[model samples]
Target: MSDGTLRLLLPRFLRRFPADLAAIVLLVLATGVATLAPVISETPLRVVLGLVFALFAPGYAFIAALFPERGPAFDGASASATADEDERSGSNLVERDESADAHTGLTERADPRRAGSIDGIERVALSFGLSIAITPLIGLVLNFTPFGIRLVPIVLSIGGFTLLASAVAALRRQALPVEERFEVPYRAWVGAARAELFEPETRLDAVLNVVLVVSLLLAVSSVGYAVMVPKSGESFSEFYLLTENESGALVADDYPQNFTVGQSQPLTIGIGNHEHEQAEYSVVAELQRVSIRNNSTTVRERQELDRFSRTVPANESANWTHDVTPSMTGERLRLVYLLYRGSPPAEPTIENAYRETHLWVNVSS
Candidate 1:
């Protein structure tokens, strides 16, 4: 491809600005990491990158767009002009002390407004604040949309906003004069940091710097560990039986109380997987003939009706309809469902099953 075509293909904001390019790259990385984190590695890289992207990137880009020109504190050109004028005035005052009028005129002519505009510190604080405010607003808007506030929607919306804001910031910066544009002093910061750590004036100073660095690293490690490897909650699964109502909705109340021999009756069995992983379940339906003496019940005989197996995802529910036909006629027959996490043993009983539910019904021939 031609050089111009390649340049044209790239974003306009990224063409000439290193800061914008870096911001765009970081945003893309964060988005990709977050979107693919579940499918990719189990490392805490996603949390780290996602936190930065969610908390800081959007606000910083927005602030940059709003204030493309260098802040008052870093307006070197304006500071230089004022410094030059002061120097000239001081020299004039030194040379012409005999003339009170000349000295007074120099003092009055000096610029009074020393502060130029918002500085680096304010910009940073504002960026954080704006980001915190903007992100939730984006989420709120997404709640109203068809996509809702899901992972993909949230990531894409925030990332899209950040990208657009960064582009606007870059364009605004480009419009400003070269000297007036706000630029992150990456090289200056690195040089200063290097000097502070490597070229400490005394042994104590060096030792203190090392301690500070270590403390920062420890703090970061602690946070990463906490976020990356969270404690697991109580693992459990929900098992229930449901019956279709007159309105065709599944309800727990309309259970079948009577069954005919060789006649199928519809019953819905549901399994909610809360085990934090995919689980395969085996459900065994049995028609039990039992004898009740006082409060104690003993099974005389049991007939297996149907067997069902299902694999359910974590935090999801699976429902299946089964037709229960009693092979033996009896009064107060126990229609039992035994749910096992894995393959059921040779004899599946209520006590052996991971979950168990039963209904009392009478069978007629």
Candidate 2:
């Protein structure tokens, strides 16, 4: 950009507070992470980042919605009294300077406290509290929608709502004149804080001193633990079934959707163990009527079609080439491969599953 453009742009952007800029970046990043799933394939990273966005972004926006203007002083009687006192002092300082000076009557600066709207500390704390309270409600609402609280939908929806709230806040703030703008009195607040730190005047001061010390220690310990703690390499398992077709050899899962009752279907079941240890596994294949109602799956007439067992080591894989056939035909039937860590049970459910996958088949009468 040209020098003229830079000069024009700097002041406008600089007027935005650090928190506001942070909110903007977070909102954009949240949406980006949700939309670009392939680019950020690491599930853990996505989950952590998503959590950060949820905890901070909406809360920050909610704070903005409530307190659009940020300035030196807070509202209420104490703040009003402080403002009046500061204004008087500034006036007196100006008067004395003007009378003493030969020229340029305005020698002393105006009081910074008069420019503020709320307590910065209180605003920050309140925002965090509100975010925690509001996030679950937002999730509840998302549950009813088609998205159903998945990564992409939740992130995008929350990010959009947060941005909208922030925009409303900025608009409300802009309604006021620039001179009367409510803003955090950064310099005055910092100076007062530092001065109080050096000379404690109240009992609260002593308590705060202890709190700060403890907080510092905790912060350091948390960082050290994160750095030194041993990581258990990824523990997981993968299972799938495959069958051949006339087109070529094919994965039954990805290709064939139709099946026949009492017709022996030649299929290969494969399991890859990344459980990071030697373990025994059980596979209970079932033909059941699976129906989803009100976000819950209802299984009925579960017929155990096949059962298999194997003990596999870490990073090892096992495969079984066998035939599986359904003895019953019904609408909305599923050929479910329920994989468990131990011996096969009389009945199988996902709750005790180490890994599970399914094949939806159209069983013709």
Candidate 3:
């Protein structure tokens, strides 16, 4: 092409090239950011980065398309008039020479900016669609694994950012000239997508809507499962007492009421659960003596109960007996019972579920 024709076309070509290049570059960068989302985010930072990339990259791409340089294409006479005017006004000849050079490519070919603008729009649309699809799948995977719960916040943050960025970019693009603005087609595509993928007449509030619905469903299901499942095999409300006497009673004063008595009394403790689910439990039992020497006080004496360490099934109970003896006289005896709704204690120790009952007897002073 002649120098004059080249100068005329150069401004438009230079303006269009950056827009096309930026669109392609932005899409590539956005994809890379998404791919690294899982790796980079130990917490919400991953989502933040993803969102930043997702919004800004495409937006800048659209901006690049919209702001292409448009230079004035002066005709021969106007160009000469400008030079003559510059000379008369004492402006340097350099200005005339540069203007002449600037108009060199006026007639080289038809504008290629149109094709660049169209390509930029298509590129942005494709990037947006791909991101929307991939992000949800990422969320789903994170939800199922042990690490899934942690990813929830990240997903939410990224999703929010994505929506905001897209909206802002679309608005900015809309303000540009029709040929320069890629956002119009993008918004149209988003509208069509909403109709095709979401409920009719419902607002297509992108990430927020999807995240809220999914989170609510998951929370409800979790609560339902917890309520429907029986928590323990051993019933927390019922306990059994089997005294050395066939009548389930221990004579408080038959032997020494304190440690002095060598005789051991056999007693059994049991717990039952009516629910159909098996439950693991921690069981506790204590033997206490009531005294009235100065005032009434209860003393819990250590007793050997061997059967408190196992899980009981639904409608089932474990019964075991231990021999307990009193060390002093005049002490009124009692047995305490406790049934736990969780795992059995790792070692024998006192727990909180015990119930207490007394057995009275006459003691010789």
In model 2, which runs have C-alpha deviations exceeding 4 angstroms? 1-52, 70-118, 188-217, 223-365
lDDT of 2 at 240: 83
The weakest ten consecutive residues by lDDT in model 2 span 103-112
Q: Give each prediction's root-mean-square deviation over alpha carbons.
A: 6.3, 11.5, 22.2
lDDT (tens digit, per residue) of candidate 2 on 80-132: 66547768866554667654463223212322234335566777777778778
Q: TM-score: which candidate is best?
A: 1
Measured against the true structure, the TM-scores of the candidates, in listed sequence, are 0.68, 0.49, 0.26
Ranking by lDDT: 1, 2, 3
Leading candidate by lDDT: 1
Looking at model 3, residue 310 earns an lDDT score of 57
Each prediction's whole-model lDDT (CA): 0.82, 0.69, 0.49
- For model 3, the stretches where C-alpha displacement exceeds 4 angstroms are 1-236, 243-260, 291-307, 343-351, 354-365
lDDT score at residue 192, model 1, on the 0-100 scale: 77
Residues 16-41 of candidate 3 have per-residue lDDT tens digits of 43333434445444545544566643
List clash counts for every candidate, in order. Answer: 1, 9, 29
